[model samples]
Target: MKPDIHPVSRPVVFRDRAAGVAFLTRSTAHSTRTIEWEDGAVHPLVDVEISSASHPFHTGTSRVLDTAGRVERFERRYGRTAPNRR
Candidate 1:
């Protein structure tokens, strides 16, 4: 209810570098950079590394870590150390 204390909610552009996609939506976040949208409206620009466009699961390109390889390397160094052995 206070002026200047409330978050500014306005239209913003989120840019995804990897997927080369730009999205326009409303947000309360602030930014110093600005750009013109496709509709010829100037708005704050937010650069993001990943989004729905480039996200692995979203794009059906998810990658799994090789935990088996890591465990083998670790055991080679520690001689396959056992935990809580009686």
Candidate 2:
């Protein structure tokens, strides 16, 4: 272990804007914003676009891409440019 060479791990709040959820955890990440936590203490606030609260996998709202429809449309427009094997 080295002195004065490691990041400080402290209690910080991560806010998921989309999910409207905030959680406190120990992290080495830093932030310029401040937020008043539920315990009435001010902590460093980090804004995140997505987290476990709003993620597709965690929320079970995953989106399926329309690749088959896209392939059909491409073939209709380009007349099957790929060669077929016997």
User: Best candidate per TM-score, number?
Assistant: 2
Enumerate clash totals for all models, in the order shown.
Answer: 0, 0
User: Which stretches in model 2 have alpha-carbon errors above 4 Å?
Assistant: 76-78, 82-86
**Each prediction's TM-score versus the true structure:** 0.70, 0.75
Relative to the true structure, how large is the alpha-carbon lDDT of every model?
A: 0.92, 0.95
What range of 10 consecutive residues in model 2 has the weakest lDDT sum?
Answer: 77-86
Backbone clash pairs for candidate 1 read none
lDDT of each residue in 1-86, candidate 2, tens digit only: 98999889999999999999999999988899999999999999999999999999999999899999999999999898757878
Residue 19 displacement in candidate 1 (angstroms): 1.0
Error of 1 at 50 (Å): 0.7
